[model samples]
Target chain A: MYKEPIFLQPKFQERIWGGKKLHTEFNYTIPNDQTGEAWVISAHPNGPSVIKNGPLAGKTLADAWNDHGELFNKSKDNHEEYPLLVKILDANDDLSVQVHPNDTYACEVEGVPYGKTECWYVLSAEPGAELVIGHHAKTKDELTAMVENQNWDTFLRRVKVTAGDFVYVPSGTIHAIGKGIVILETQQSSDITYRVYDYDRTDSVGNKRELHLDRAIEVTEVPHQDADKEQSVSTVHQLTVKKLVEEKYFTVYHWHLFGQASELKLNQDFLQLV
Target chain B: MIDGEATLTVDGKTFEVEKGSHFILPHGLSDYDLSGDAEFIVSHV
Candidate 1:
């Protein structure tokens, strides 16, 4: 029986708005100061987390999920990619306004099993830090017009955030992580992103990144609605558990340990802890 | 999870989890132990 915990090595990714906070905070051996994200517990094909211990050491997370279904309590007859991913992001600068497609749109167009629905647990946020959670457009046509005109000041919506905040970002919500924020993100195992705007900033190579306005507008939900969740907290011995979100794609929890908890029983489903 | 080192016990084996270490508690494991002074975020599909 596969009883040991599956340790994963983070896969660092560089981004235009990336910074050195990942290495400074996580102590990861990053490739450069521009490291933006660490795919901490991922099984996606783009950047799978490598197993770090036990017999699975050196094997990619995808390998384990494909070869050892029992470990995940998945049926042998079922065939699907691992459906959850955990990431740590350091946004030193503003991220491009972006949106993601739903599962139906993803399957019909991108031919992927899941779309990007994600949530973030703020690890650290500089004072006055803000995020573009949604937009002010009342309709799709309005949103399209605002985008076409580059009317960001009046078209975008912003919210100030602090450390220890939880943000839910459902697919189709136009959002961006503002500068000076580090977050631990739990997301659906999909990499498809539709960039809506990029602040007219060019990369180190002096070229603008491509924008997926057509697809982004097509997938974006009109009249943005905030996904508000009622949080519930409980204590299990010394560990205080806060249920951040339990949604269609994933259920997330924050565990604050005052000391230690021993002999914790596991449920049938596999859990990714980060 | 993200934080200081956490001591974990699975079956009869013990593992030391460092800061920023992320792991999966796969199925078929009945009970485990976590002894440390740290925080963690756990999720499932």
Candidate 2:
């Protein structure tokens, strides 16, 4: 039996307002022969767990996932669909208020096989960093009026966030990662995001990114005011029901901790491709 | 269930496969038709 819990090095991306912070923290040491990229961890058509020691020393996580599917209960070939995409995002500037379509919407409207459902574990934040999730408007008419009249302040529920906070974002939630924050996001392997608002910011081309106005209008829920309680205060174990407002084809759990351990008993015909 | 490409010598043959990229071989191929330095992960559901 293996005694060590595998360590997954993270991947880094350079976004328009993203900082060089995530690249520095999560990347591991590479040997002289291996290559390194801004993106370190790859949930390739291959897997998520990297082999620490053996003949296949530098092989990727996907390769291990394919070879050892039975131990994790994953189907060898089809297991490529769920890549454990973990990233440390440093938002030097505010991100767009965005919503993701679930599997059904993605498959029907956009013809994507998978949709994004991600969670954020905030590692650090500035003095007044805030996250925009959902809205105070209860009805579609109120939400439309708020967006049309540019009542961004009243429409968005601004929650003051700090380090070590876990925010589960199911598909279709209108949310954004505010500036002055660094976070680790874990989610499904899909990269489809629907932007609702961009804080009126423009790209390098000097054009505002397109907003998914109609879809956001259909998907946004009433603002969740008590999002801070999602973190585990006393212990590293927190079981917050994150998908109360929206449901998806898959369920996810957020574990915020240091030196924590838990046992998982597999009773279902499912796979645990860690 | 197909053979690895590293084993095939005649080479200019292709087949349709959705599940794997490097494991398929042409018809009338057998293990004796293979050569040195060939390895592949065999999986079945």
Candidate 3:
């Protein structure tokens, strides 16, 4: 019997490649200039969003999901945790080249409920901004050999991007967010990242970040292929709906409201995030 | 909502929302009404 919208407070995370754009662009009171990501709508144990209104005010989204399952149309047969996470990332510098495991690997090896299969909606980008999208390896052996030989230039595929662009990075896809890019990301609620490579950047303590080479080699898709997402567009009243990517885990849409529209919350089992 | 202001009525409660406002309309809620001029980007599972 729930009504009213649920507004959640974002939790910020700091990273070496982070910047102040989350604050500058979103007017969020970022913790520091190095803040990298704002977990806007999340229920992960690492950083759950706090509800800001109604009877659930002050409760974490995790609490609501576990306690008030009906709000999410959860039934007794479904025991899985919340299925999605939304984030805003600001890459002041290049992020580490990385890949993530799929559900089977994540559960069997990492003991996590879900694996990370994420999509990015570029909020803004600097001129010539590029991202590591995939690799040039023809096979798993080639991929391993290139990684072992440190032949980065010949092994990685970089793509130029700009504002309003959308990229879908599926599980096992070797990818990285290049410098000076800000994006909104939607993904499975998991944080298991296997860093394939870092640009030899050292921390303040003069220690280089650890690289999960073995796991990365194990999970990365050899001869990486870009995901094929067929976008569809439609309009209802003042809202222009753009279907970005529809996959097994989740379907993402971009809604552009020009004037006004009366939206009905149909008897769907899942809640909507804005 | 991304831009402009709006009054959102859910059940018998009302909320004032403006640009940059992010919200989730819970499942099973009745037909909520939004009146005003605004832009928004929304997603769901």
Q: Tens digits of per-residue lDDT for model 1 on A153-265?
A: 98888999999999999999999999999999999999999999999999878999999999999998889999899999998878889999999889999888777798898
> Which sections of candidate 3 miss by over 4 Å?
B1-7, B35-39
The Cα error of candidate 2 at residue A153, in Å, is 1.4
Clashing pairs for predicted structure model 3, backbone only: none
True contacts kept of each: 0.92, 0.00, 0.69
By DockQ, the best candidate is 1
Please report, as a residue range, the 10-residue window in candidate 3 chain A with the lowest summed lDDT: A265-274
As a whole number from 0 to 100, the lDDT of residue A218 in candidate 1 is 93
Estimated TM-score per prediction? 0.98, 0.62, 0.95
Specify the poorest-scoring 10-residue window by lDDT in model 1 chain A: A259-268
Docking class of 2: incorrect
lDDT for A197 in candidate 3 is 89
Superposed model 2: Cα runs more than 4 Å off: A1-9, A23-68, A76-80, A222-274, B1-45
The digit string of per-residue lDDT tens for model 2 on A73-100 reads: 5655574453445444667788888778
Candidate 2 clash figure, as a count: 3
Name the candidate, 2 or 3, with the larger lDDT value.
Answer: 3
Note the DockQ of each predicted structure.
Answer: 0.85, 0.02, 0.61
RMSD of 3: 1.7
